[model samples]
Target: MKKLMLMLVSAAALTAHSAMAKDTLTISVYSFAQDAYKKALYDPFEEICDCELVIETGNSVERMAKIEANAADPVIDMAVISSHDALSLAQKGLIAPLDISKLSNHAKLYPAAQDPIGNNMAVGYTFYASSIVYRDDLVKIKSWGDLLGKDLAGQVSLPNITGTQGPLTLMMLDKALNGGSGDFSSVIAKIGEDADDIVTFYSRSSELAQLMNQEEVIAAPLGRFAWSRFKNSPLSFAWAEPEEGQAGGMNVMIMTKGNGNEELAYKLMDYWLSTEVQTRIAEALIDSPANKDVVVSDEVADNLTYGADLINSLNILSPAEIIANRDAWVEQWNAEVIK
Candidate 1:
């Protein structure tokens, strides 16, 4: 009878353990600085929630495709993607409107970050300034037009039209060339004209960093979030204060529609946006906080997209504009620039 009791007790314990293991939340995020994120945000939240976090990291295109492919049954409970990408998903009805009540930290974010894409479909997590990164000793970057100039010929890298930095670069170049028209046909044609002199149109900031480090690329347009890599390199690099000003945007978080893990997803998102977590992330120089409450050291601030002044100064592109125009931009790019 005692032996039978022991077996039943063990079976119950195993069942409880299985139940705990079943509670997991999956999040899709950009593929960068996972180690820092794991330390600053993921592990702490996992401890608090007593659940496993399945992190799926990739570029926006790949993550978006997965969300769309699994729309009938969402594989990702939540995702951190470009605001425009989230808008695209929302338009497809692949993501659900966020329950703002569930996010305690929602009230603490920047006013602009609050309802960034509207309908509570997404929330901004980080803001980044995109501009030129160039070797100070090799070249002087005065304007967006420098990429097309003969001085930087065969030494400059441009972001591919599909990536986040691509359109921002085009915007700044457009501004520099023709006083900032949203239309980029003229800029595209100009880039195409100088395509032979360009090293390559990079899709990833990390790729641009690699090329720059190797001396294959003397200058490139990149986001400030990716600045730490170039800053720490042995080679001298400078972040240009371009005459057209820096273009910027925010990366946001969104919930996948029909993903039954809404509660856990909300808990994680709330934790990530909290002042404590935002400060930790900012101090680590991992991400620029969208939570206005986050405060970091001045040294840390220098490394990140910190300060309301700088954030306000950024010439941000519209997420809605990007979503509406990306497909046409890609088509034109393939036909003109890539050709």
Candidate 2:
């Protein structure tokens, strides 16, 4: 009958449509600002590539563990993590070197961001300046030494040794106390001596911000990326510029080893690092742009760690140094600072 013939044709069309759906591109990233990322980058990328964007979010360590566990069959097609974390993955052969030629926007990145880890395993996506965040009404943080000073005793929170901010904090504290010799033992000892005075050693910036908002703490060292939480708050807060200078670090994008999705992955990465997308992300205050061509309004710039001058001024820690010293640093930290 004519009705049966029409039904058969409709069924065939549905099957063909289902078969023609685009492939999925999986990405692992930090658990911060996903909503803004969705609006500014992910949705647009998915549309352009005609692929489903599968996002997995967590802290760096957990995501790294996931990639390592699934090494034989990668669950994540691509990722964005701290440069040091990416390097760690590279050393273990857990990630693949990016083909710069595939990323059309790769040439627009700052020279420092172009090959931060040097193995082509990753490329920088954003930079952050680290320093103290203090309640302006309650504390006067003139130097990194102020964290251990008697004035803010029992009212300060320090980043834990396991986190990125922790080592940067130690670096500044080392400079403050020992004139930047790169040895943080004395700095750890000083914190150990003042252990009881410190409110807690926080792992997440959000945790630090919460404590400050509740008045449980007056000051804590944090990354510029997290400044918006406190800056927008009803309570007064200030980002301190210490005599030792601010510490800086970069986050990078990488491809998981043998994920079998290189072309689509590169397409997404390229789009994410392009001037147009980077500018939008900067405008949303989700990240400080790594693409040098991105220009934003001053009002938007105020919320970001923008400009080459400030980036150059930062006392950046080398990813190699962090990797080489981290284990020993954590061991020393637990024995001294936590004891």
Candidate 1: TM-score? 0.95
Give candidate 2 regions above 4 Å deviation. Answer: 1-14
Whole-structure CA lDDT of model 2: 0.90
lDDT of 1 by residue, 34-138 (tens): 898899999999888888999998777788899999889889999998888888889999999998999999999988888989999999889988889999998
lDDT per model vs. reference: 0.89, 0.90
Leading candidate by TM-score: 1
How do the predictions measure up, each by TM-score?
0.95, 0.94
lDDT of 2 at 25: 91
Candidate 2 residue lDDT tens string, 1-339: 999999999999999999898899999987777888999999988778778999998777789999999999999999998888888899999999889999999899999999999978899889999999998887788899888999999999999987778888899999888999898888888898889999999987778888999999999999988887888799999989898899999999999989999999998889989999999999888899999999999998877888898899999889899899999888988898887
